[model samples]
Target chain A: MSKLTIVANIKAKADKVDLVKAELLKLIEVTRAETGCISYDLHQDNANPAHFMFYENWQSRELWQIHMNNQHLADYVAATEGAVVEFTLNEMTIID
Target chain B: MSKLTIVANIKAKADKVDLVKAELLKLIEVTRAETGCISYDLHQDNANPAHFMFYENWQSRELWQIHMNNQHLADYVAATEGAVVEFTLNEMTIID
Candidate 1:
């Protein structure tokens, strides 16, 4: 199976930056321990405090999908509801 | 000097996907040889062939800025002119 690369960009409401950031940080530890997880790194934009991105790699798309449906991710979604102003997700594969 | 992570997204004009992708691919080898480059990986969207992204890590923003001004990058810009439809760049820091 081919590796999966996920680039998920999230922007928080101006006033809810910290709340959204905290919720995003909460996902890191648990998600990193999941099966097939290769790398799960979170980044915050230097110019836009409200912008956050997750640059993740998984062994395969199947494993990534399982990770996506995990309870913790659901909790993250529920916790950050309405606080996220924009969200975009891309499932990609390395060109090489 | 803190490390920098760059997420650059490029979208090709509908009819110019191949041209833009080839131009982008021409960048990898030269860029990876530059100073302070840690990783310079490229990805293509699984659902959107016209979308390409470069996920890069650098030792410092200063080094990355130097890379940004290099001749090879200028060449890439020249080569891909009018072939690219959309581009977005984010300079980010890991939330460790």
Candidate 2:
């Protein structure tokens, strides 16, 4: 049980990008229904209306740290404070 | 000329990971060299052993179409056949 990949590079506020893309599509469908989620995808940057990407997969890393302490992604990160100017997170494996 | 984003998910055989990785390093460099390319990042799932992604952005679609025709990438595709188990590509736009 060691499958976990989470790559997120979110930057918003190019005129609020349609209210942060409708709150990131309900936060990627509630993080793909948690519980060792296998996939959760979200993307943007058709010219960078404030670049964004959140492609995730899990089955380990302690269930992705309990899906980042659930609670609706901590209330959608406190309702997207400041609309997230910039963020980055990357953890990957599988060298082939 | 608007912005464009390209995300590619490439998979490789669980065993042949090393060899292809080296070849890919060069491929990515060349693609990134394209005149309009803004970003091109590659990633793989930690547990899947046969899952990957390629995140890319360009200034416009015309240049990206040309990039697809680049000879080097054509060659890499030929070099790794069975090793790739699954692949996917996504196109996105900022909706906010």
Candidate 3:
């Protein structure tokens, strides 16, 4: 199985930045402890406070899929439903 | 100085995937050797061949700015001018 890299960008609604960010930060600890997780780091844009990104590396795509379908992720979706305005996810492979 | 994380997404014109990728790859060696570089990893989308991203970490934003203004980056811009269709850069700080 090949390693997978995920770049997920999340943009919060103008009035919901804190709400959205809190929910995102909550995912880090649990996700980092999951099986096959290599690294799960979160960042907030320096110039755009409402923009956040997760730069993650997983042992394999299959394990990443498992992580995606976990209950905590569902909880996140429910918690930030309307607070998130734009979300884009890219599943990538390292060039090397 | 605070550390900086950069998420740069680049999309190539459908027919120019190889060209754009080659040019992007050309920056790795020199950029990695730069003074403040911590990591300069590149990735290509698994589902979209034309989508490429660079996930970089630097010792500080000031050092990153220096890297941005260096000749290799300028050369990359010139080399992939018409071949790239979209580009977005996010300068960020790790949440901790």
Candidate 4:
């Protein structure tokens, strides 16, 4: 298993950013607590109010998969259903 | 002059990334050569072929403005006219 980088691009609904933000921060904390997590960061694009990006580094793909299936994630997905407009998930293997 | 961090999120046309990429790399090199530039890096989102990000650091906002007005950047913008779908520019003052 190699190190994995996940870049999740999310766009939350207008005026619901606070609710979305709360859920995302909690999820980020939980993700960081996961055994395989190396680092997890949440960034909101300054110019785009609805745009958000999560930068995550995991020890292995297996551990990352475990993270995806975690109980908390289900709640997060359900809570932010319509609030999220675009969600793009990318898996990266860093070269430099 | 305070440090300036610029995050430029760009979306290029499908299958036209090669042309856009060439322009971007050239602009990046020119920006890096500027006296105020500290670092300039270009990254393409692995899962989103159209998505690109330029992480740039400059000594000041004035220098960044100069970079923006440079002839190379004008050419880059013109060359990538229809090829670009979205371009979000963010000015950040680092806290940490």
lDDT tens readout by residue for model 4, A1-96: 778777677889888888888888778667888999997767776567677777677999899999999999999999888888889887765432
Off by over 4 Å in 2: A1-20, A25-67, A70-96
Fraction of native Cα-Cα interface contacts (under 8 Å, chains A and B) also present in model 2: 0.36
* Model 3 CA deviation exceeding 4 Å by range: none
Residue-level lDDT of model 2, residues B26-92, one tens digit each, is 6787888888998777766555545666767789888988998989888888887676777666566
Clash pairs (backbone) in predicted model 4: none
Q: Which stretches of candidate 4 lie over 4 Å from their true place?
A: A1-5, A33-39, A57-63, A78-86, A90-96, B1-7, B13-15, B29-39, B47-50, B55-64, B78-96
Model 3 lDDT per residue over B25-86, tens place: 99999999999999999999999999999999999989999999999999999998899999
lDDT of 4 at B81: 86
Q: Kindly list the per-residue Cα lDDT of model 1 for residues A7-59, writing each as its tens digit.
A: 99999999999999999999999999999999999999999999999999999
Candidate number achieving the greatest DockQ relative to the actual structure: 1
Question: Reference contacts recovered by each candidate, as fractions?
Answer: 0.76, 0.36, 0.76, 0.18
Model 1 chain B, TM? Answer: 0.97
- Residue A94 of model 3: what lDDT? 96
Q: Looking at model 1 chain A, which ten-residue stretch has the lowest summed lDDT?
A: A87-96
Ranking by DockQ: 1, 3, 4, 2
Score each candidate by Cα lDDT.
0.95, 0.73, 0.94, 0.79
Q: CAPRI verdict on model 2?
A: incorrect
User: Ten consecutive residues with minimal summed lDDT in candidate 2 chain B?
Assistant: B87-96
Q: Can you give the lDDT of residue A62 in candidate 4?
A: 92
Question: Scoring model 1 with DockQ, what do you get?
Answer: 0.81
